[model samples]
Target: MRAADRPADLRRDLVVSGEIHYFRLDPAEWADRLDTAVRTGVTAVATYVPWLVHELPDGTFDFGQRHPHLDLVRFLDLCAERGLSVIARPGPFVMAELKNEGLGYSVLRRNPEIRAAGWDGERRPETIVDYLHPAFLAAVDTWFDAVIPLLAAHAVDRGGPIVGIQLDNEIGMLPWVTNRPDLSDRTVAEFVEGLVATTSREAVQARYGVGATSFDVTDPATWGPALRSPVDEQVLALHRDLGRFTRDRYARYVQHLRAGVRARGVGEDVALLVNIHGCWGERATMFPLGISQLHRTWADGDTIPGTDIYIGDLDLDTLPGLWTSTAFLAATCRADQPYGVLEFEVGSGDYGEALDVTTGPEAAGLKLQLAIAQGGSLVNYYLLAGGRNPELFEPVGDGNDRIAFTGERHGFAAPIRPEGDLATWFAETVHLTEAVTDAAELLRAARPERPPVTIGFVVDHYMTEYRYPGSTREAEFVAELERFRGSGPREIMTRALVVGGYAPDATLLDGPDALADLPTDRVLALAPTPSLDDDLQRALADWVRRGGRLLLSGPVPQHDMEGRPATALIDALGLDVGPTHAATPGRTPFVAPSITPDGPAWQGAEVAVGFAQPLTTRRADAGTAPLAHLARTGEPCVLDIGLGAGRVVVAAADLPCLPQIWDALLARLGAHPRIRITSDSRGVVVVPCRTPDDVEVVHVINVSPWDTAVALERDGRPVTDEPIALARRSGTWLVRRSGETRARVAYRPPRG
Candidate 1:
């Protein structure tokens, strides 16, 4: 069905959902808990229908006959009666601290072949199944066959409350580590089949030479490469291809599940939801195989792919990852679809290993604000209330004590307490819900403006798993690529951009289309690895041909994605790449340093690290113009060349490491933000979103510990003459429409 013909629920904005596990709570208290959901201004209630809970020990289905609380249809009807929408999660694998990760105990006992095998050919620590194993898929199909029809009956299109259906929960968390690849036979067969279908054996032999005949693609340890002083070309190719194949399998798994959901006859407005885990660096780096490609894997027009964001003590330092991941997810999602935070933290849960998240309305409000500012539309609070686990095991020692799965009173400091009383966060929840409702019409139609500077990125470069691991020349090159494109240019520079009061846009350099649609007036910063995708090289050449200003860092592309020499963009620019010179700390400097704190990239900056000077260069032709020179070499380190109507700025030094250099470069280009924001303090992120009707709202968030006087201006003219003093670690939204511009002063902060 066409999107326009879908139900009004699809177009209606402001979805404030709270998760309430109906099966975990008593049937008598379900009405009261649901009442709390509506009273706290929740438009919807989300619940996970565990397969283990519903399926009896005899492999027969039991929705509510045995226990009244197990009646999912009845629970959903109750939510509808209370005017609340429902997000039903019928997970064949729901990891809610349950035995077997919510899969029925008999499931694994009956079908041990479904269990995912680790890299060492051992079963995974958790009862996680290999996603594509025949046995597993069969089991899941049986489960879905039983559950989908029931969910379809309760769907909103049929006058039921179910608006969304979640396929699986954290799909790849069980074996996400590097050495934890699912090495099961079925998984290996699929991987081999995919490789044979997509890759050419002749090319593989040519690249690997004579000894490639003995290498087995089906073997896990012998799958990719054997570490050596100098890795063979065949090994490298095999490794890279393996990474691609793995990513493809993950994508196919989601695709298959989504098809399963769609085949169940779900309505157009009743969307399928897939949640991607880990919004920050630690998880992204550790599980690069899954987290890196999950966004790209679950890319579908009808499905909503959302991230799971948990703000605990470990993740406080990398809050910007939330913004980066959100931006990437939004970019990766279907155009016009609202990106959501599927599992947003409501509060800390005291079950299993305790996670202590600060419990206060201010922190909760701040997280919600940040998500919205970073372009999150649909947000589901992880839990709205706590509940007791059902009796699954018999008593062993004490008469009153039974072997409960996650302990009886699984308390999560949420809006509703275990006894059904309102928590302190109730008011905060209501406030955010009301605020989103008031601005829903405008926000639903609004899109973030392109930043003055856009960071062009290649996904493969950041996918560390694709890199051939060894001490070989190829390995060293990959290491250099990691360093060149890793920290300074990507993370630190983005932080600099944000702190400078500009909402930087991260543009994925996948193909020519992303480049063609790039803001023509803005500066495109392209800091990529030495190995570039051939298609991207062609796109870059095309982009240069059509008058697009670019900032090129690191070495010129010497190889393609397949490790073949390709210099399409380099040849077009007509540049002579020269020798490298490592800059000494506190010694190496710009030839003539002239820096002023003018632009947002340079506002109140005090950088301690030495700037990264990558290499020195000299122009190959007279078409280039020298901009700046390296002090150590006096060679042309920074130069600009005119291509067609556009100009390209090539820098030898890493622009991110040197904020002053970045500032000077921007100054030279005469590039400035369209809207200017000035603050009395630092660490405030100012994001401006404009609706289709040109209704603009600026969201100012203080990420620091101190308060600040903030002022906003468009084209150097103040929207309001007076500067407002914003509270520390708070967000103040300023909206202006039809000549009426003002701050939301009546909006209360969290009281002491």
Candidate 2:
């Protein structure tokens, strides 16, 4: 491919990257994963700098400072040998399910005050070290003081392979997926400093046109209460003011860490990134508008300008919601640095140490994540080759507090076993890395724009419900909403727009000012809550009258609880009626047994569409237009009709909130261009290097002593043998075509 056709270089973007834990996999295997990484075309490697492991207890520090297995220096040497880059995670509290919050037993038992506080003023037993606490900083300082210097020297800038340093693991509870406990006097103090420095009650206000005098002049504690949501809501809004407070303050802490890494000499060349809990996307918060307070800290920081990448810990393989969530983060960057998937799921292995079952080898999740992650700079996977988490070294607490010995919540289902079992999952990862890294030059340059579909949605808000039990009232509803989450909203919008024969891809970011070349009267059915902004509202109004079509499943809302009417826009569309309630409550059969819409929009996927009782409407004009209604006992609860030259679709029920309904509705929206690849849910997929001359030189396997080959696809064309490797033990094979393009690979099952 030519230069322009080649994708942008996402930080060493290779699919075959592996995860190596600090406390796990014998250091001896370090060379093995590295060699496998190279043969697999893995350009980068990721490892967590477990605070608990290095610090052992407070005041003490260790590296290979004692054991060669613990040797940090030699590890980088291996990375350099293989021309691999590194992503380091040093968490004062890296909760990879370590005992005592990843802090060696000493920190937890000795530094009780550092733990976060609950609403009751007692320290939460689950966490260790208040994120912003000074003592915590001092403790981390003791660790960084010893190791960061070594990392700084090995950073890519210094001709070594270390490229990115992750600060803290995942601040948000994530995946199965905290409290903003500012109860610590230190947090309160830092909150004051941050407000004074970045806010504006005079000193506090800058962009939003608000102002506060001194930091103390404003009651910051009140800010927390304003953001309170139901316990079921896993996320809280990081609105501008509060967002600034939380973000800027958190930025201060990151800055401290960044500086320490820099002082050690890692400098600006080694990028610094913060990982957000992917579940944060479920929080229902808007971007720049509703990013959680904790996320905004890194998401909106200017401390380290060039280091503009913000990440999230999402194993997006099976969960479609996380795909768009990661994509959205890339969109929010001021500098538009590449979006990075800090912790892509490698496999469905263990949830917690207790769950000893493995997820799968095709790593079905990585397939889609890379599609989005490729939009930016880098995508890294953790525990690329997990062995055992170091022996709890020096038992820390209530013997029950062990992450390693217990395994994941389901079981110890890692791609590679702690006992060094090399499953097919590991082989697949190696194969994927080889394909991606070999073509890194070209693949890195390709930028696949989201297809021209108008059926996409943003990912945010609603994490709490998925991670744990939600409020009794909304739990079930919440769970259902996430059903079709893995399928992206953008994809839905694009596909519908495309199949409908519209050029939505060219003018999707429409309305008015966004792109004037587009027509003004195009309407889209927006599934929104009261959170829609005034600007978007105004834009929608202008476009509708100018001939845009809008099919609101509900009404063009005119007011919020504050009773403020967003009149200018709502009045123009003239949708002033309230909803028609469903009769018979839960028994309402709104879902039609077999309802179908015109064209490809409703193609594929199974959805239930029910008939409804017709309801009354004032400005209803129906002729030659499509009408879709969902109702109760023949009474119309959802009504779709045209208003002026535009359309208005309303539903009394928020069933579309359910994953099933949402996906079906999206299908009817339209179809887009996509190349489907079948993959297993091993978490991480494999990529391999190939040339016309070496098309038949790869192999892969699944489980019980087997092997196979991964294929390669380019601009809708394939160019090599499918990739292949070994299982928990090992295996091998040869390619078929030595110089032909191959789009997809089909691996065989291992012989029992």
TM-score of each: 0.85, 0.66
Best by lDDT: 1
| Error of model 2, residue 40, in angstroms | 3.7
Which pairs of residues clash in candidate 1, taking residues 3 or more apart in a chain or in different chains? 547-646
lDDT of 2 by residue, 631-691 (tens): 2233334444444554444443434323334334433333222321222312222223233
User: CA lDDT of 444 in candidate 2?
Assistant: 45
True-structure Cα RMSD, model 2: 9.4
